[model samples]
Structure formats: structure tokens, C-alpha cells
Target: MAPVISSLNPNHGPPTGGTAVTINGSGFTGVTSVKFGIVAVASFTLVSDSQITTTAPAGTGSVALTVTSPLGTSNGVTYTYSVGPVITGLSPASGSTSGGNTVTISGSGFTGASSVHFGTASASFTVVSDTQITATAPGGTGSVPVTVTTSVATSSNVTYTYVNSTAPVITGLNPNQGPTSGGNTVTISGTGLSGTSSVLFGSHSATITAITSTQITVTAPGGAAQPVSVTVTTSAGTSNALPYFYITAPTIAGLIPTTGPGGGGNAVTIFGSSLALTSAVHFGSAAATNITVNSDSQITATAPPNVGTVLVTATTPGGTSTVGLGDAYYIYVAAPVINSLIPATGSVSGGDDVLISGSNFTYIDAVFFGTAPASFAAVSDTQVVATSPAGAVGPVIVTVHSSGGTSNGATFQYQL
Candidate 1:
């Protein structure tokens, strides 16, 4: 009985055909030949009595495909060969020369596409469907014809354009210098800042906060002391580097005799590094009266009138010193006064506990009995208990000395 052919897998192929076709039919073993039209297939495999696989030779148009075994020739099945692929359109026909742009191609006969080209450059491509292909363009310049080549033929129906890349330009930076710890926002102005991929300070990368064609805002990254290059990168290219300075914030290591009167007229010497460019000195919220940048390590500033303990800060172009780090402090006190004295008279033997009453005596450093130093204990903010020293039989004045200033003398009589 003659073999009966039912179907052929992939009934169509390119005209320059090398397509593998699977024949499904009722066929016995010992298949002698498989033919497409009058041409014979050079390579074929008989998997079973009901299936045969064969390679189609180069041909064009539709033709009768048949299998002939020792028993009888199989009934003919039809197979058609396709023409070349045709590209109709290209999405994003223009891109930067730096390349890495995805272009979508819409066309017909795109199935089994072998190669895609942009001018003389070969592009990596993927066939999405019979009518679509997505390609990643290679680096190129100027306009180029894009083509898709199949086994049968190649089609050139679209043009891809390569535009000259524009490098980013930096015009200026706001608050150029910052603390080494770095979390300050810096506004960078320039051209071609749009689509920025990276913002780098020195070798560190900054976090981008906002971006525009002419401006970009980014948070600075921590860096060492010195100047570093700041640059922006986009798809086009890297921009010219701008200088960014990483400065250590001014520090106040010591304040000479860190206490003063509430009237605030004392010149306090500030000792620290990074003080050369001192712009402002602050005592709490009050600005200093006179600020002198004595050197990079020292500053002389007049303490502003303030009360209690206040933080002192030195400011420069880099940044201001942080408050409450110790060392940088000034305690403002009300000047001590001589209100009265208990036991105003004492024996010349110099053994007497005199209770001195006054305001602003909390920090008393010394007590004097008629120009002689005496032992004293600060009883409170307004009182000091002092031992009167030996003196000649006469009227002696007792006084207290504190950071607030020396108190007025109170008359004390000493008996000979």
C-alpha cells in the first residue's frame, strides 16, 4: 500500500532554504528518498515508521514535498519558500555616538532573522516576532542605513542616525566647601546636566537629589582634607571636572580664661586650627564684638555680653565649629559687690571666720584681707566665708575675687 502524507512541520522557509522539516504520515521503514519538487534532499533521518526529518535544499516558491520508500511513494505535501525581510520603521532612529541605545524595528518577514546591521557596524538583535526586532546599536557616527539579513536575502529599508555626544559642563557650584563628614547639598550649574548618571566628588559618589538640563543638586560625600575633582557623567560623556574643596570645620580648642563679666568687653584668645579665614565669632547667639584671625591656629575675639555659660563658635569659609564640644565656652557672670560683712572687727592675731555677703560670688578664686591673701570658701552664689589674715591695728578692707571680678572692699577693723 502507498504511504499517505498528512502534514509537514514548518511548511515554509526562506528561498535560500536550509530549514529542517519534520514529515508526519503513515510510512513504513526503508524510505529511499525525500524530495522537494524535483530536487532531492541530501540529508534526512527516519525517526519511526510514522515520522521523517529532512533538510530542505535551496529553492524558491511553493513546491510538492514527497517521501518514497520501497513499498510506494508518499502522497505529495506542499511547502513554500519566503522572500527577504522588509524593514518599515525604526523607533528612536537617532542616538548618541557613545551608544548603548535600544532601537525597535518594525517590519515583515522578520522570523528567523540572521543578522542586523547599522551601516557597516553589526548590531546585536533579537527577533521579537515575525514582524518586529529589537536591536542594541553599536558605537557609530553620522547616518547609516539599517538592514536585516535573512538566509534568503538582506533588506535595507531604514536609516539610523548617530549624533555627536555633548559632554557636561560645569558653570558653578554653591557652597563649594563643606565639612569633611559631608552631608551638605550642593547645587551644580552647567549645560548638558540632564540624564546624569553619576555625580562624583573626588573619588566618592554623591547622591543626586534633583536634576535638570542646566542644574543638578546632590548631597556631598565624605572626603579627606584637600581639594578634589567634582564631575558629572551622562550617556553622552563625562563633563569637565570642577574643583571641590573638603575642609575641616574650624575648631576652638581653648578659650583663654574662659570666664568673663556680663558686660562683655574682654578679649578672649581662641586657640585651634582652621581659623585663618574667620568670618564671624559667636558667643551663643550674640556675635562677637571684634574678631581677629591671628593665625590658622588662633583667633582673638571679644566675648559678647551674655549670661551663664554660652557656647563659643568660630566661623570661616569652610564651616563653623560645633557647639558644646568643650573648650569653646565662656561663662558670663554678674560682677560681685560688697554688700556687708559679719564680725567687722577682728583681732590682729588673724584667726577669724568672716561671713562676707555679696552678689555673684559663686566662683571666688581668692579673698584678700587688706592687700593680703586670705583663705576663703565659696558658701553660695552670693556669699563667701573667709579667714581674716593678721594685720596691724587699723581699719582693713576685706574683698573677694571671682571670675565675675573683684568685689568692692568692705571695712574690717583689726585690734592690736
Candidate 2:
């Protein structure tokens, strides 16, 4: 029986060929040859008794695709070879010199696009439809012609322009001064900052938190106590430099009534230089409240709750004071308690050496015998020695006083 030709899958392809054509027909078994017009296909596979897959050889225009076997020659099926891709337009005609923009090229005959180019530079591309292709523009400068190439030919009706970018400009910085230790957020306002790649303070790079066309927020990096140049960089160029200052940390020379109750809440007068802008006062890791800046050299703050001795520090825009820098010590002590006294009886004439034993005896300021003040020496955290003062011949209440507070009284007898 003679082979009966039915149809060809993908009846049209580029003129350069290499298109895979599937011939569907009857009597295709033992197929000896397949041809496009009078040209023989070099590669083919007999998929089944009714099917033959073959590569279309290089050709032009429409041609008769046919199959031959021992039974007979099959009737011809029509297949047309197409011209190269045509470029009608580009979605974005201009982009940055650094490139990386996706441009849509629209036209016809794009079925087998081999490459897309911007001038001499080849771009990565994807064929979206028969008339449209998306290509990523490669890095380039100035105006460049865009073209699409198929296996058969190349089209060059569109142009792509590379625009040179403008450098970012820094106009001002909010809260421009900060501690040498850094970690403060600063807002930078400027122009042409849309695509900022980097922000530098002096030679240190700052961490950008937020960015916009005209402003950027960044966390300042640590730097020396001096003025440094701040600049922004983008694909275009580096911006002009602006001044940013790093101030020295405040020093705490002293604190009035440097000792306080363990439960805190005592008012402390802090003396130091660069204290005008004090933002915080810390007892150890706890922050003080109700802070009042009296002058450039003084601040009064209420101590936060704490225990034991802690280094007091004042924080300003300049920075935080370090421990051991000056007289910045604060001792949190529990009130002294007098449990007993060694000599319970003393003469009214005065001068009696008495040993007072109790808890929290360190930093004892004074000892009281009735209404008279007695001299005392802090022997340890739990003991004190005192010389009793003269008092009326009667039972006298003896008490110890410290920065923590006065202790409960113990009765002592004074004899005439």
C-alpha cells in the first residue's frame, strides 16, 4: 500500500533549519528517507509504523516535506522556513551604565531567537512569545543599538541608550554629633541618593537602616574624637564630603554623697566636664531617673535601685564615661544595725572605749550616745569601735550612723 501523508508538527521554522518535524502518516514503516523539497534530511528516527521524526535541513521559503518507504512514496506535507527576528520597539530605551535592566523587545518572527545584543555586547534573553522577547541589558555606556538574531538573520530596528548616573549629594545630617563609641542613628538628607551603594563616615562604613531618593538613615560607626568626612557613593560616582564630628565622652569628676541606700532613690549631684548634654546616668547597668542637668559641669540625678558598689557614669552625645576615670564611685550600703555593745555601762564623765557589733558596719559616719555624738571607727562590714561621749546619768540610746542610714538604738547605762 502507498504511504498516506497526514500532517507535520511545527509546519514552519527558521530558514537556517535544525527544526524538529514530526511526520504523521500511514505506511511509514521501513521508511528509507525523509526530505524537505528535493533536499535530504541527514538525521531522522523511525518513531513508529505511522510516525517519523526528522531534523529539517537549511532551506528557505515553503517546501514539500515527504517520507519514502518500500511500500511507496508518501504524499507531501507543507513546511515553511521563516526569516530572522524583527525588533519593533524597546520597553525602556534608556538605563544606567551599570545595566542590569530587563528590556522587552517586541516584533515578529522571534520563534527561534538565537541572541540579543546591545551594540557589540551580547545580552541574556528569553523568548516570551512569537513577537516578544525579554532581555537583560549588559553593562554599557552611551547610546547603543539593540538587535535580535535568529539562526537565519539579525534584526536591528531598535536602539538602547546607556545613561550616566549622577553622584549622590549630602546636604545635612540630623544629630550630627555622637559618641566615639558609636551605635547612634543619624539621618542624612541629600539629593540624588536614590541608588546609594555605600555611606562612609571618615573611613568607616555606616550601616544603612533606611534609604530614599533624598534621605538615608544609618547607624554611626565608632571613630576617634574628631571631625570626619561623610560621603555617599552610587554607580554614578562618590558625592561631595560633609563634616561629621565625634565628640569625646563626658568625664565624671565626682558625685556628692557618693554612698546611698541599697534600695536606691537618693539624689546625687554629679560634677564633670562636657555634662551639658547628658542623656543618661547609670548606676552599674541600671539607668538613673529624674536627671537634671544643672550646667556644663554639673548634673543631679536620682539613683536607680541597685546593690553593692557600682561605678557611676554619665552618658551624653559625646559618649559614656569609663570607670576609674575620676571620682565616679557609688557605694550602695544597707543601714548599720547595732546588735550589742561591749561595755553596757559608762560614767557620765565621758571617754569610754566600747565595741559595737552588728551588720553593715562599714562606712559608719558617727556613733551617738544619748544626745551627744561619739567617735567611731569602722572595724569591718559587721563591727565598729567607738569612744562614748559624756551624757547624763541615765539609760542612753546608742546608735550608729552611716551613709546608708542610722541604725536602731541599743540601751546603755550612764552612772553618775
Candidate 3:
């Protein structure tokens, strides 16, 4: 009961043989041969004992077939000879699905390979000889057809093609602005910005490392106070916000006088432009006897007394500039103490006619003996009528001209 071959006639032939096959079965007795693999079929004829009559030889496709019995052997079925699998080549037709692709498939029968498909994906093959086969491509979408499935009995339509590779695209982000405590180092152009997975300034996700394709280096995420929009993410999607901006540092706009004269020298002229960084120009709270930061919008302070209107500020690093225009400047009367003046002497070449009395010559505007040019004729605002044009006389200083001021010196005499 070891004989089974229910039909086989010209099923397919060609490997070097004419054709004339006929073999139906059911316990063929003592027939000792009929094999289409290992090639051998030169006109067989048993005719009964179940039946056997063949004529086909020459090999390439369709095999794993057998029939040789004395009472044993006849279980491998399939015999279609005429060669069919022939694909030519395929080594890296494109890949990405996280599939770790490593393809290499040449053509012709690929010996003993039972499966290797890339279209519906079921790959993991290896048959490196007889025409190469080293596959690992399973996660397809665009192009597919690199197949090789064999169980022997030959069957081939021959095919190999699979491609799907796309990863890159992002666009815009230059100064987008930021400041909520965020550091700010943003530059993200676009178009597949090289492997950048994240960089957002609006939703708050920054700290992206440097990457390129158009450039992407990010560090901005504190909470966003003003400027927004800036996004970039890759794997293939997300990029189109681009706008960053944030500014809040430079303020102090009103303080012209606010208060002056307390022993705090008093020359106060802080107009405000960050006041050029005036550290202490306080007058109502005390501490501004002398502070001079002349530019950035002027500051010449000298006033500290605990006054009635206090508030004139200027601080930098981008943070304080207050000048609310309160106004204060007045503490006069201490102008008239020309202590002593007797006879000192004067004479350089011009006749010395001198007599200067001192006390507090008010508002005087003309008198000089050392720099020569004194021809005063006032005498009654503390006295004056000085005529000493070319002077070099030792201790000489007599200046007095009135209107309620000018005369902190007097002592003259020159006769040569």
C-alpha cells in the first residue's frame, strides 16, 4: 500500500526530453523507478500494477517528484519542468518602517528559499548562494514585489521591487522673540531640518540640540511673555509657526528735579535716558550729594535731605528709569563770606589803582587783576574802580561787581 501517483502526463516538460507522460495509480507493484528530480525518465512502461508510462527528461523547474517501488518510496509530489523564476537583481530598493532593511536578491530559482516577500511584507530570508538572497524588508507602502517562496515543485513569476523613503520638511523661524526667563537661542529654518525632533517656543518645549538641513538650534521656553510662534518637529511632519519676540527692559521716564540741596552738593540735572546708569541720585530719601553721569540723557545730581517730593530714578541692566516730574531745588543763602582782605600788592607794567572793599558783592560780572583786564568803575556794591591791566604783583586778588553777588576776594597795592 505504498504507491500513489494519480496522474502525470505532459504536465509540463523541458530539460532535455520529448514528451509523452501517463501515470495513474493505486498500489503499483514492483515498478522500480520514476523520478523527475535527480533527473531520470527515459521511456518508462509498466502498464499495469496500477500503471506507468513516461517520456520526459532535461531539468530546471518543477521537482521533488518521486515513484520507485518494490514496496517503498512515493510521497514527494509535483513535477512541472520548464524553469520559471528569474528576477535579475534587487539590493536596497528603498526602505523605512523601522524594518532594518538588508536586501540582496539576484535571480534564478534561489534554491530552497521558502519565503521572502516585500509587498505584503513577510521577510526574513537567507540563502546566499545559487543566486543570492539575504532579505529583511517588511513594512512596505510604495513599491513592492521581491518575492521568492519555494517548496520545490517550482512556481515563479519572478519579481523584486520596493521603495518608500521620505523624511524632511520644516519651514520658518528667525527671531520669533522670547523672554519669560527663557535663554533664547533660536534659529530654525526649514525643509527637512535634519533629524530635528522638537523645537517649540509657543507651546513651551525647547532645548533642542543643533541640527542641520537649513539649521535648527533651540533654547527658549520660560512661559512666553510676548513674541510667539516657532515650531519644528521631524519624522516628516510639523513645521510652520515661525515668529519669536520678547522685550521688556528700559523704563524710567520722569524726573527733572524732584528735590535738591541738603548738603548733597546740588547740581542736579538728571533728565533720564537710563540716566547713563546713575546709581545713587536720591534727594528725598537721601544720597545724592554728587553724582554725575552726563550722558544717555544727562544726570548731574547733588541733593539729599528727606524732602517732600521723592522719586528720581535710573538703574540699568535694563530695569529701572523713573522720573515722574516732582521737582525740587532751593536752599540758598551762604554766599557772602569773603573773610579777609588787606594789602597784598600788584604791578606788572600797568598803573595799579586799587581799593576793593569786600562782603558779598551781589551779582558782579567784571573784575580781574591776575589775568589783567580790570578797569572797573563801580565802587558801590562793595566798591570797585580797579585799573590793573598787566599784573604780576605777588598776593593779588580783588574782584567785585554787584547786583547782589560776586566778590569773594580783595587785597591790593602796586607801586613801582
Candidate 4:
């Protein structure tokens, strides 16, 4: 099938030729030749299957332009040779009173434009081609007639209105802190952000995901672990900047009382840096509750009911703490219990080693011999060795304590 020529960018240029033009259409791949009215284009470059670029060849009056490919020859479009600069239209015919916004003036015969004037004031301008010139509106007030000047002739006048417009104002940024490795979405709340041209974090540009008159969402770029200025730019000007922080990922140096009961509800202190914004703490797949951040290096959260061993991690806006960086492992065990006491009796003067057998005694914290406390050693999950403390010659109730809870009471006798 033959390629198609939709339209030409300039349609017109100097009779002497050498005007840059972009051919827009479809099926442009493998284009073999191009011609400006049978004169044959000097050279042409195929940009894509839908576009082509080439210099307009020297021609007189109106001529047909076409592209040829191995499939077939394309239809021709009329291309004209310009005699002088002409102004057909202006984009954003209005700008701020203080000026400095780029305005595009579009028309044919723009080749060799020497200057652009807003009323009597000369404005800086760049000729993009025979059809477009971009001018930075000079400071002015009220409406002014803008015209383009070339050696051959001055283009027709077009009205450019000047009025004061407020620069954007930023009120806040949600989740303003994120991992230094970046790739986090941050929402910006502000005013006058319509038609925003760019959003910058510090000096780096962020990819805008969405935008509106009062809010914008952007994918943050990678940055250092420090504070940076976040700002937005639009036609009016750059907005007021808000502070953003780039934080490194949180770490877990250690988890105090690394083991607890499967029933849960125990305070566990997490120690590490970059934890000031900790939002969640997890033990295995279960989330902890009542999390309180003590500082940048510490947080306390009630362990949730979970069984077996699991990696404990703290998550913040900065990032989640990874395992292998610290003591991030936790185990859940059953409560220690005292099934029976050996000899069950000890001297009132206080030193007697007793054998305490029970279920779940692996993490015994302490043992009670009646009203007095006793020193104890856990030999296994179900046994403990304890020395009775001095007391009056009488019987006392004995118990065991562990991460689970206090165990059922067992009888222990004291004698004279």
C-alpha cells in the first residue's frame, strides 16, 4: 500500500529553499524518495513509519510534494514559496504583566525573521521555521499589537494581551518523605497550578502523574537522604516551595524480648535509625498494634498474636526495615507452667535445690516459693532448677513466670 501525506509543517518557505520541514502522516517506513513538484527532494530522512524530515527544496510558486516507497507512491500536497513574514495566529495571546513567558506565533513566510515587537517594545524571538516564531513576551501593560520583522517585509499585527496573574502557591505535600532510592508517589496540594510546565524536587525534575488546579501527583526522582525544596512551575511563574525529605530505608538493629506467646499482646522495642515516621510494625504476617515511636532510633509496638518465628520489621514513609540488618527475628512460645515440685519441701533457713517439672518452661523468668521469690534455671521447655529462699517454717504456693504469663499455683512445703 502507498504511504500517506497528511500535512506539511510550514507548507511555505523562502523561494531560495533550505527550510526545515516535518512530513506528517502514516506508512512512511522505507521511504525511498521525495519530490518537491517533480524537482526531486535533495535528501530526506525517515523519522518513523508515521513521520519524515527533510529540507524544502528550491522551488517557485505552488508545487506538489510527495513521498515514494517500495510499496507505492504517496499522494501529493501543495507546498508554497513564501514572499515575506506573515502572522496568522498566536498561542496564549495573553501573558503576565511582568512578561517572560514564551508565546508561539504561527503563520507562513516567517523565514529570516529579524525581530518581534509587542507594540513599540522589541521582544526576544527565535524563528523555529518559516511558519513559527517563539517570542518571550517583554514586560508591558494592556493589549499590544505584536508583529514579526524580516528583511523583505513586516508580518501582519496580532493582539497580545498583558494582565497580572498570580504565581502558584503550595500549601502542603503528602508523604513528603520517601526512600532515597526514589520511585514513590507524592501528592502536592496547592493553588494556581493549572497549566503547570514542570514539577521539581530540589533541582531535579519529577515525573508528573496527574495534575489539576489545586493538586498534583508526581513520581519522585532519586535523591540524597536530606531535605530538598519542592516547587511547581506554570505560565504565571514558579510556585512557593515546600520542604521534602529523602530518607534511607529503616533498619532493625535488634528487637527486645525477641520471643513472646502465640496469644500476643507484649511490648517489643525496635532499635534502629530512620524510624521517626514509623507507621507500622509487623511480626511475620501479622501487624502489631499500639505502635509508639520514641525517636529516630526506637519504637515500641504490642506484638500481635502469631505462631512460630517471623521477621520483625518497622515500616515508615521512608521505607520498611529489611532483615539481615539487625536482630529482626521473633519467636512465639507457650506459657511456662509448674506441674509439680520435687521433695516439695525445703529448710526454713532458706537453701534447698528443688526440681520443678512443668509444661512450657523454656523461658522462665522467675519462680515463686510460697510468698518468697526463688532463683531458677530452665533446663528445657518443661523443667526448671530452683533454690528456695529463706522463709518462716510454713507451706507456700509456688508459680512460674514467662513471656506467656504466670502459671497455675503448685504446693511447696517449708519445714523447721
Tens digits of per-residue lDDT for model 1, 271-315: 988898788999999999778888999889888788989888888
Which candidate ranks first by TM-score, i.e. highest?
A: 4
Tens-digit per-residue lDDT, 113-193, candidate 4: 888999999999999988999999999999999999875457779999987788999999998788888899999998988
lDDT tens string, model 2, 1-416? 87778998878777778888888888888888888999999979988888888888999889998888887788888999887778889877777798876788989988788888899999999999999999988999888899888755688568788888766788999888998989999999999887676899999999999999999999999999899999997655688998999988889989998898887888999988888889999999999999999999999999988898899998888978876556898999899898999899998888889999999887788889876898878889888888988888889899988888889999999998
The estimated TM-scores of all candidates read 0.59, 0.55, 0.23, 0.61
- What's the lDDT of the predicted structure labeled candidate 2? 0.87
- Sort by TM-score, top down from the best: 4, 1, 2, 3
Candidate 3 lDDT? 0.60
Candidate 2 versus truth, CA RMSD in Å, comes to 10.6
Clashes of 1: 0
On TM-score, the stronger of 1 and 4 is 4
| lDDT values for all models | 0.87, 0.87, 0.60, 0.88
